[model samples]
Target: MRRSVPMQRLDGLVDPRQGLGAAEAQARSARYGLNVIIPGVRSGWRTTLADTLRDPMLWFLLATGALFMLIGSYTEALIMLLALVPLFGMDAYLHRRTQASVEGLSGRLATTARVLRDGSQRTVPAETLVPGDLVLVRSGEFFPADGLIVAGEELQVDESTLTGEAWPVRKQVVEQGLFSHIRETAVEDVYWGMAGTRQLTGHAWLRVTLTGAETLYGEVVRSAVAGPHAQTPLQRSVAHLVKVLIVAAIVFCLALAWLRYHQGHGLVDALLSALTLAIAALPEEFPVVLTFFLGVGVYRLARRRALVRRSLVVESIGRVSCVCSDKTGTLTEGRLRLTHLLPMSNISEQRLQTLAAAASQADSGDPLDEAVLSNCPPPVEQHILARFPFTEDRRKATMVSEQEDGLLVAVKGAPEVVLGLCELPEAERRDWLAAVEAYSNDGHKVIGCAYRTLTSEAWTGANQIGG
Candidate 1:
């Protein structure tokens, strides 16, 4: 909440180089409690019970019982209403099961954090972090609290939890005196680093600004956990079925009542008789059966440490056959391994890996680049002088590196695109194309690597030079 950036306010709270002293941090931690969001107080059994009573099937059953009471069938109405007892009890039990499974996961706090204290980096418990703490987060680590990025490498983060998007977001350093990033919601607010988001690719230095409910990630979790969830597919289907059944019951009852009146029966007597028959014809076991089945699913899922926010959603999840993942493809163990390398006859395996690494952004947070860097270090004597980043249309990344002899152009990307960039004999090209096809058939994610020398005529403006 403080408007002062980390450096200017060194006298009171944070020292630019040392962050907060150990004693000062402890006092601040006491002022702001542990960074945990507890939504169970509002979203527990009461909310689930309310949702169950509002269900279409239960609503219809209650309405029918109330109609029986209007017709002076007190004993029958009471019996029908009493039947709801087990339904409510069973729903409550299932709600507890699902809630218990996720409680530990939702309330989990990061056990360790790397922070600057007394002018030296110290590893401490994440929950002890306060607003003024200067934190350093690296690749594959979750941020402990919300803060503003002061400096970092090619930092990228997975913000899918907040945006429901599957792509990595690149973060930029905040220039001095630019305070607009604190409240602004733009994706370009590269200075903002929210708590709980995983840092995908770089070392970042951030000054902690907010924690607990005040942080963006914490707010999202609070709303999702405590508030009413949107209707799921199964809920909609059951409601539609209930509506159709209610309409049919009304139509059949009206016809029966009309026929009775036509046969000279008294109007009131005929109407009462029709209503009774309609009530009896209704399937009283329908609600009981459906609720019982979903309850079983909730119990089973809870045993495996999985929780469905709504019990009815258990049925929806069961119906899934082929689930296509988001644009990033299937999720893995947060790493990638370079399993194979097939190089050209003119190049060795290390040479091929070196060229691929030269084309990649160092610590760019891209899995492909990380895999290549792990395989071989980039040529030590060469460094990129110009870069053309990859895009959907480009399907490749190209870098021009200054070498001792000349400028070396290194490229890596989809095989078809990379092959077009290389000047090879037609026969060799065809043979390589066949090889690519065979490799793809074996389920390998192949990337093409190539290098070429810049011509004397290509020496011109940076952007105008050929890749």
Candidate 2:
């Protein structure tokens, strides 16, 4: 016999409910805290100029230019100065463009959810969300705050934006680890940054465990900002080539200066000749050429709908030996649709309509259920029975009501569960199982719906029923 794991529960959590006074909402907002904006420091013109002058390559070029000017080599000095202008300008333009992009991103505001507080739900900006606030999350809604699962059944959330994991993670109120246990599961609310997750079926409430810059997604963005941008292969190779050229130029210049001096050339003439040689040996136009190549790459990548954060990163992409990608969004469309429906028995058209109507009414707005109910005819509202909410564990929803002939029961869930509950012919069962396996192998999700008739005396709660 197998032993069951006991469910864990904690305290100090509140359920989300509608109805809050204006004052209460304000108080909640105040208690949670406000969004803080940090400004970037501006660089002064003098500072920028000093930084440009401090570059080793720039210093070398300047020294060469000065030596040429001292020896009356005006043409070479002017050429070297002209080369410096474009390199400096390109560097300035790239820096300004990057700053503008970051600034624009900071200015855009993300939407916040209206969550229940002290009996009333109030809409607030996402930035205003604070830890310990109760939030309400629903199907087709984004999570505004990061919180612990307090009270929920079958809550599945898509964390691809933050975790980069394609599959939706199933969440429960109970803590699963140290990070999860930090918040009280009873009063956690889901926030908007995680809004891409859709409710498949079932209701849940979350308490705000983290907010603002402390949220998991916020941390991810922060880390990305701090992490070094990947360098492209071209950028790496170009950098290496530049270093080698500089070293070769210096060695060649020293050798020529010694040779010219020994050949009875005057100090001034020999120094000027060495400087001219250095300038010629160094590819002063390399920086300008590399900048143009990077610009072309950036334009091409942008046209393909790929944003290159750094120009150098483009070269890195060219050097990648292997690529890893998630199948859900990268390979296939993330949305799952109902492609086919199978009714268990050869029921009348009217009976089919009734079952569909009942399922629609208690669907909790899941996409799959909505699709099934879309073509359903008008249902007899009065004949509807108490709804049994769908849960991942049970994998089914059962509807039952007293009928004039007997008791009518309808069940819907994963095919395996429905098939096991229904007494179908062996051949038919094998065929249906085969169909389900085929769909699964083809990457199409499949579900089953079944209906049956029984005596009122046989009715029992879902816990007592084996199916």
TM-score of 1: 0.51
Which runs in model 1 stand beyond 4 Å of their true positions?
Answer: 1-18, 37-109, 164-167, 179-187, 229-290, 296-307, 312-366, 369-446, 451-467
TM-score, every prediction? 0.51, 0.60
Tens digits of per-residue lDDT for model 1, 1-467: 22233333223433334488889888877887765543344456669788687766677668778878877889878876876775677677766755664465454335578999878999988877887888999877778877778777667776655555545677777764454333333334467787767787678887777777777777766665666656667667666776777788888889999989999998997899788877777665566567668777877887886656677678878888997764432354444679998997778887888888999876555667778888786777776678776655567788888887887888888888888877788999999999999989986778888877875467563533232
Residue 251 alpha-carbon offset, candidate 2, angstroms: 6.5
lDDT string for model 2 (174-232, tens) is 44453244443232233222333444444556555555555555555456445665445
TM-score, cand. 2: 0.60
What's the lDDT for all of these models?
A: 0.72, 0.59
Q: Which candidate number has the best TM-score?
A: 2
> What is the Cα-based lDDT of residue 380 in candidate 1?
75
State each candidate's clash count. Answer: 0, 25
